[model samples]
Target: MSDLAISVRGLTKVFGGRRVVDGFDMDVPKGAIYGFLGPNGSGKTTTIRMMCGLLTPEAGDGTCLGFDILRQSQEIKGRVGYMTQRFSLYEDLTIRENLDFIGRMYRMKDRGARVDRALVDLGLAERAGQLAGSLSGGWKQRLSLAACMLHEPELLMLDEPTAGVDPKARRDFWDEIRRLSARGVTVLVSTHYMDEAVQCDFIAYIAYGRKLISGTPKDIPRLVGLQTWVVEAGEVGTLEAALKADPDVAQVARFGAMLHVSGTDEARLEAVRQRHPGQWQKLDGGLEEAFIWLMSGAQDNFAGPAARGGA
Candidate 1:
């Protein structure tokens, strides 16, 4: 078997004459937790759908789980488990009922055993009889994950699975994701949360239907070539204004009481630091800074009078 679980090139998708996803390329290795990130309408979801064979690409060729994405969608779908941004399980059904139904759809030989195991594994055994509709957002998320894993698919594709959930619940969900990854199940997840993005083994940032950057978390900031200085002062708003006016500072973001000032030119940034008063600590920029820097250069496809809700 190939080391890569998914490989695609020149993937494109159009809606209303706008290229929602344009000439995309991606490679997801087996057992990797890949983070797919982009701004709203940047085609993150569209690209994922095409990769999983749920949506056909206008122009592209790829293999998912060694199955031809265009010619063997059914084969690809069978080996992949998909969880959408929204909770999609039958709300009227009990937790156990939902799992059983999914197992039936997959025609699993150990349907009953799998449902029981899923409920137990996801900490839903006690609430097995509870209606899915009555569960909280976190519980519903847990149920969705449980349902997705019911078929024991080789790959798990989750779209913002932690969105709107409590912090603790989000942490718990990621713990489960890591456990699955440790068990050699490849995971492809989309999330806007930087905390979650940091946990990914690989990351790809897309914008305006094009890829801005992709690499390990540590390498992303370096690749963007941003030099950042953390500014600690009694009045950050005033300093923020000052930095924004300076031509050298490319980006200034307020983080709590401090400000993170960054720019592409290291010498210019250092010069700005010497001019500023208060505490200034120079350090490497992180994922958040790189994300903002990459996003600033992208042109939104929906901007102007020709806007469409394509994404």
Candidate 2:
């Protein structure tokens, strides 16, 4: 418990009589880059809010940064920096103004020096006078991060922080996140990009308000128990149709000119591979394949009783 930055159990939240986050549990280690992953509308946001003291859980109990999530939420909030899915900063204000405003909101001491340092640290000093509204997606993201770090909080909860940023900008954002983790600041970020997810030290996959799996990036696919083979040929489309017809191939996914066929039974998958005339290479399933397989089997809680029954 001492080494954990966040620990929660049976965390539940309901909206319109439907459980958005149902009996969720999690343990995020201190100074670790933990990836919070899930399909859209899977309640990842609600869970993050509950863990960081932004939203109260109707059920469950836990602590964040040594403060009780329920009883000491204010204490927890003081130590956590939360960035929402959407940019929440004042767009009309300049980068420096936004950081200064955030500092004032926290009533931070030495606001000028702190804002100046944040500007330099995030490479925003040259553009300090630029209005946030005029900045690109990448620049706005950098400003948001700079604002979040003004108080030097011990924990950061970023919800889809790199969604619209370019490839280089995304890479730069992750580099900073790594630096913060190295300095003992725990970071929990949600992302849809597989490349970004692989950068995390730990990952948790969720769907339909339920946590399906959590582990180190290297172990997630193995833990899901999938055996996969990559098949490539000139007639990939034709091969894909034939592979899908085989009952043994539980999952068939097209990756450019190749198809990833996966299943729990290695022997069955091998049989399907032998039946197809292509360049079949047996390999361990990747995170994308594991997630696709996981999501395909998940039941949508919002569906009607008949739909759920059919599913």
Candidate 3:
């Protein structure tokens, strides 16, 4: 029994002459909420699939839940729950019926009791008789999560599970995830939302099929060595454009009336600030600022696979 739920090295996947998931390595501790963050087409989903045994990696050696990912895929599958990005249950069936069917598929004994317990645990007991297709986005998400947990797998992998749901629904989903984690279920969740990323025990930021950074959200900013300043003033649009045009300003983004200006070069950033002293106010760097700077420094995999390296 290893402490790591997932341990892999040199995992690679190529498609149509493009290295969708380049040589990647990961070590996820047991019962931890590991958030996988990246932009679109950054290979987040592909990497998750390989790790969970849904897709075989072109090159890699690892174990998932103490089972060999390559040689014991079927055994691994039985002990892992995978929630896809979209709702994948039988929408035409009632919530209870859908859950019962899943229990039967897994061939679990006491199917009725298991279904009942799952509904109660996921707060779907009230909606048990409702057709899944008629439920709102939030309810649908809850039902999907319940179905995934019916088998009670030790490891859970969720890919963008909160995508189109409302804010309240997203918050509810995260609450359930945290509860599961507390009960000793390891979770690997892929998300683009920074708010959700903060909730994870640790995060791995991937870009162009390679992981650029991995650490606690608080440690990521410090690791990147970024200096940021928040600018507040009238006519923020003018200030944002001015900062974006300057090479000294690595990144500039507007948040309501305030603009966030950041750069890796401390001296150059100071020079920019000196020139626009009256137009902007300076403040400390934030997680979002650090993430933007990290992304800017990463090389896009447009040319080909990333050369083997470490950050």
Candidate 4:
């Protein structure tokens, strides 16, 4: 447990007679970038809040950054940085003003120096005078991260930090996170992007408030027990319908110009694939395919197949 940045078990939360998070357990190693992933309302944010001491779990005990989540919540909160899904900082405030404000909120003696360092660290030194409202989504994300880092917390709990940002900005944001992890800062970030989820040292997928899968990215594919094949045709109009008719083809989706067909039953899937005609290529299972298959099997509490959106 000493090597863990977050250790929690039986973490549960409820609201309005609905269980939002149920019997969730997790262990995130220190200095590791841990990805918390799930569809919307899968309890990723609620679990983060519980681990960070912002919201108490109705049925759980844990320690975050060496502090008890229930008893030492204040201490845990003081040492951790949390960024919400939305831009919560003052939009009208300039980058410098925002950092200064956060620094003052932490009541640090060298507030100016810390803010300056944060600006330099986040590449906002030059744009420190620009208003956050006028900045792009990526820039606003950087500001929010800078705000979270003002006090130099040991853990960063970012909930979908790259939601509306561009690809380049998202990449840059993740690059900085890697730098922080290299400096021995433990980061727990929740994101729906498979590209971003792949960047973490460890990742966990939750569905309907239950943890579906958790492990290193390399191992998660194996956990799902999937076999895959790629099929490409000038127009796979009939081929797709044919594959769907077979029960062995558990999952099928168009991947760009081609279609990625997957199933847990490799023998049956391969047999079906052999019978089909197209540019057939046997492929290894992937994270995106695994997640899609997993989500399809899980029940969505709030809405139907088309109504819900996530990972």
Candidate 5:
């Protein structure tokens, strides 16, 4: 078997004469947890669909799980599990019933045994008889994951699986993902949450269907070449406007009480700081700062007046 679980290159997809994803490429090794990070409407979903063979790319060449993506889509589908952004299961059914139904769909040899194992594996054995509709957001997410894994797929594609889930629940979900990876299951997950992105083995940042950067989280900051500083003071709003007006401040965002200011040119950023001495304090620029700077530098493909609702 190939070391790569997914390999695609020159992938392009267009809708309404506008490129939603353009010349995309990615390589994911087996058992690796790859994070796909981007703003909403940045083509992250489109790219994932193409990689998983759910939607054909307008132009691309690739393989998923060693199957030709263009010709062996069916084979790829069977070996991969996809969890959509929304809750897609029958809420009226009990948790156990849902797993049983999925097992039957896969035509597993022992559907009952598979369901029993799934219940235990996801910590849902005690609540097996409870209606899925009655479960909390976190519990519902767990049920969705259980359904996806019932067939024991080699790769899992999760799209914002933890959105709206509590902090503890999100942490637990990631723990489960890591545990699965240890057992040699490859995962490709898309998320806007920075905390979640930090958990992945590698991360790819995409915008308007174009891949901007892909590497470990630590490497991405260096690749973007951003110099960031945190500013905290009494008149933060005033300082923010002043910083935004400066040519050197490429990006400025408020995180609680402090404003994070960043720029690609370190020398220019320092010049701006010197000009506004004592107005802002300098501090280390973290991953969030780098991401903001990177995103600010990207041209939004959906920026036109007509693309407002479409994006």
Candidate 6:
């Protein structure tokens, strides 16, 4: 089999006469955790659905798990394990029951053994009889993951699986995902958290349904060509306001107690710094800085003056 689990181009999805996902392209290598990140309305979810064969794109050609997205959607679906944003397992059913139910849906030959193994793999064997609803968010996440793995899918698609999960739980869940990836399961997960996005083997940042950049987390910042400096001052808002009026200052954001001042051109950014001198430190930028730069350049395709609804 090819090393690329997903390879697609020009994936488009239109809703209400607006292209929510416009001419998107992505490539996820097999057994790698690929992070899909963007603002809420930037079409991250829409693009993943198209890639997973759940939502048909208006125009695109792609292969997911080696099945043609356009012509073999059913084949694609069968091999892909999808876990949605919400907790999708039955609340009333026990953990083992949920796994059994999923196994039955797939009509596995040894349903009982499959359920037992899933429980053991997910560390839910002790609580096999406990109701899914009663479990904590992290446990619920574990249950959802266990259910998805019941079919032994080649690809796993997770949509914001750590939204409400606690920090420790989120870390543990990601560790599990990495374990799966190491076992030759390709994982494509979407997340808003920058920390989580940085953990992926590869990342793709999309804005307004268009891809802004795709690369290793380390490569993205350098590729964006952002020059960043941190201003450590008692009054950041005052300095931020003062720099906002300057044309050379491309972006100014508060990072904890400090201010992250950045721009595309180093000379221009330095000029902005010289204009407002203080206890500042010039440092290498990271993914968060590059993402903000990407967002600033993206246009809201649906927020145009005509043909749109008002809030």
lDDT per residue (tens digit) for residues 43-144 in model 2: 899999998888889999998998999989888877899998999999999888899999998889899999998888877799999988998999889888
lDDT values for all models: 0.88, 0.87, 0.85, 0.86, 0.85, 0.85
In candidate 3 the C-alpha lDDT for residue 176 amounts to: 93
Tell me each candidate's RMSD, in Å, in order. Answer: 1.9, 2.2, 3.3, 2.9, 2.4, 2.3
User: What does candidate 6 score in Cα RMSD to the true structure?
Assistant: 2.3
Let me know the TM-score candidate 4 reaches against the reference structure.
Answer: 0.93
Candidate 4 — worst ten consecutive residues by lDDT sum? 302-311
Top candidate on TM-score is 1
As a whole number from 0 to 100, the lDDT of residue 191 in candidate 1 is: 93
Candidate 5 segments exceeding 4 Å error: 278-285, 300-310
Per-prediction TM-score: 0.96, 0.95, 0.92, 0.93, 0.91, 0.91
The residue ranges of model 6 lying beyond 4 angstroms of the native Cα positions read 300-311
Residues 204-260, model 5: lDDT tens digits? 998767898999988777788877787777887888889889988888889888888
Cα lDDT of model 4 by residue, 12-110, tens digit: 998655678889999999999999888787889889988888897889898998899999988987899999999998888998898888888788899
Error of 1 at 174 (Å): 0.7
Between candidates 2 and 6, the one scoring higher on TM-score is: 2
Clashes of each: 0, 0, 0, 0, 0, 0
Ten consecutive residues with minimal summed lDDT in candidate 2? 302-311
Model 3 spans > 4 angstroms off: 278-285, 299-311
155-219: candidate 1 lDDT, tens digit per residue: 99998899899999999999999999999999999999999999999999988787778999888
Residue 93 in candidate 1, Cα distance off native in Å: 1.0
Q: In what order do the candidates fall by TM-score, top score first?
A: 1, 2, 4, 3, 6, 5
Predicted structure 1, TM vs. truth: 0.96
* Candidates by lDDT, descending order: 1, 2, 4, 5, 6, 3
